[model samples]
Target: MSSKSDTIQVGMTNTFACSYLPEQQEQLLVLQENTLNVELFEQLLTLGFRRSGETLYKPHCPNCRACQPIRIPVKHFSASRRQKRTLKHNRDLSWSIVNTTSDEHYQLYQQYIEQRHHDGPMYPPSRAQYDNFIQCAWHQPQLIEVRDNKELIGVAITDVLPNSLSAIYSFFSPTQEKRSMGSLMILIQCRIAKLMGKDFLYLGYQIDASRKMNYKKAYQPYEILTANGWQQSE
Candidate 1:
């Protein structure tokens, strides 16, 4: 089998203000190729690369190395007391997976960005932004939709690879804050990955300094990328 390093070409982007870290700058090592596919993404995911829309990139910051790629070893994962409670709490909701996006998805996503992330970079949500950010050309992303008696409450955008599942992004009805929908979606993804016989669930980057983006650590016994290789974290 040929290695990823042998097949892919990469280039670095100009430094920009870090989205997660306000005081830092961010740069990305992006894949420079015309033909990108899920099979190729599987290899990139193993190397700490992530997808935003259709672009595949990994952090290559100059001054800071705070953005660490994190993944859960699905077979070995053991949920904490809180996670178990979250699962129990949302047991009443229905979960289904689809391979396409809809206007309803955009409505919920817009509401999520506008209400919860107004102060963030994706604020003033527009239809164009949502479509561009979510849709991809190579493959149709999986939509894990959660509902309450026919009402849409949460959606988790995920990418399915041969050996792993990458969580692209998730958003919930802001009005359902008490449901802990965000964490619930993640827990659901972990379960789905295990059910699909996948080895890992890629939860994107874990930036310890960002309070809002640091919750992936609660998933016990995750592996984070390092200079040497993926290291297990307790």
Candidate 2:
């Protein structure tokens, strides 16, 4: 029998409104594999691809190249002053990795989207949306759960691959914004990747124009996929 990995297919999407850039359109090159594995996905990650649930895609915009795929070399990474402060501040919190999701996860996600992303496409978060956006159909992702005493404050949707961990999405209690839970969750992912002896932590894309989405570069010693291949930025 031919293996599902024998012949992989890929497709592209029509140009649409760019979610991050107001004046540009966006396009994507998507992988259409019937079955995906960590080894294959890690190869794709090195080529600047990212996952949204079960689908893997990379920006193929004709007129713009704002989406730069970025990843941190966990061994070479140095926390910035602000990121160090974030780590120190979040020391009181506890984190654990799990392969399942719960109502608590959905509740925090709903609250986060309703309060923080109401102006965006995922404003009216629903169970269906939550399932499609965060839960994968092919593989179960590792969810990093953070808590304060007994309260579930944050959840980071992460994909654990053979050589790296991909940051899919993260949501936290909007009331806990002061804790910088978003950044804290990312730091946690990095720590986990380091402990696992992974070489990189794929951080999706680094969009320079979007104030809300451009923070990925803050993780120093990250590499961005370029026409010349993965180039290190110090």
Candidate 3:
């Protein structure tokens, strides 16, 4: 559940300011729901809303709104040569969705954190912690799986909103590091969006200059939300 004390603030931003930085941080009420129907979610996602815990928040910050909700313009997206190769590398893979968590997922997640983000939160997440982070009761799962020969290789947990999909978290077997599986999973989602005729991908925060968060910017022809409205960042 989101804290009632949660708040956002916005202000003037220089060219170097982050995309999420808003010029007018305003207050907007948070919505708590036990479930989000898929059709209704599509609408909210298009409007820039994201759900965390049991709370849903759009870009409701004070004096700022630069962090625009973004989605992959899938119909227009082209896989780079490298992305295509990555897809081919995992061609032996296929996937299916399952309800509830699995020990295999938890183990891969722990390995991913320990190897790629030793300092991240899931390094030692308990079962409850993992559930709260990925299997929240508020949102139905829109998970994607990447596997080969029926052996699971990766997981991308997302929540589908009205206009776009919110990628909450993803992980892979660190042992499969050579596969570029993380990027490949994202590429798969872009195709899924295109097939579904969705307009955006809603990649969360892309902290400018943060090495760990840098990859989010490559989805060119995308827009960044600001005080005025969604503006192309291309």
Candidate 4:
């Protein structure tokens, strides 16, 4: 690794198969520093970097421009009528944010992955994988746990930064498809970010070609990081 500063070092990983698109390869510019603080990580996010466990990476694909980093300008975000309905429908569920992971969270994650993501890379979930993927040595991500009365239903693993909150990953009960817990989790993050006086909610990469990912556009007034800089969606 090459030191860029006292608190940041940089490196690049060899090209690997793209996880979000089929038959496409991906390369990443990575931050390989120890004890990364929130302030530095927040700066990285603005530059299109995301955290996977303790590592921070930005897509460096040579041929493709499909992965666009996106964020919501919280103060300007207004919920669509459909999104408003989603909030009203699931108003019975309560959410609490915490800084640690638990056995219950892992169990829900395993069930969600096995049921909803069996065809993806994260299939056949295990505790070791969960720990390595969700927990980081330098950053303690917040877990937004959603419960229906007394039953655990969803979790949003989030990285809280100096001026924004990054929605790292979210999973929910596969059986409750009608509840749209995935969308609900994101809405909750937006609400939390607004409440915390944050200006933006960093939502990782928005790949318009992928059916699973294209929905990110639904969060209107969002900005996509481009060569010209952060461009607002029409």
Highest lDDT scorer: 1
lDDT of 2 by residue, 213-234 (tens): 8999889899999999999995
Q: TM-scores of the models, in the given order?
A: 0.95, 0.95, 0.74, 0.95
| Cα lDDT of model 1 by residue, 185-220, tens digit | 999999999999999999999999998889999998
- TM-score of model 2 relative to the true fold? 0.95
Over the stretch 1-234, how does candidate 4's per-residue lDDT look in tens digits? Answer: 356455455788898888888778899998867768789899889899999988899989878889999999988899999999999999899999988999999999999999889988888899999999888878899999999997889999998888999999998888779998888999999999999999999999999888888888898889999998999988
What is the C-alpha local distance difference test score of each model?
Answer: 0.91, 0.89, 0.66, 0.90
lDDT of 3 by residue, 146-225 (tens): 78676778998876555566677788887788889878778877776666677777776554545666676676666665
* Model 1 spans with C-alpha error above 4 angstroms: 1-7
Candidate 2: stretches off by over 4 Å: 1-5
Clashes of each: 0, 0, 34, 0
TM-score of 3: 0.74
- The root-mean-square deviation over C-alpha atoms between each candidate and the true structure, in angstroms, is 2.0, 2.1, 6.8, 1.9
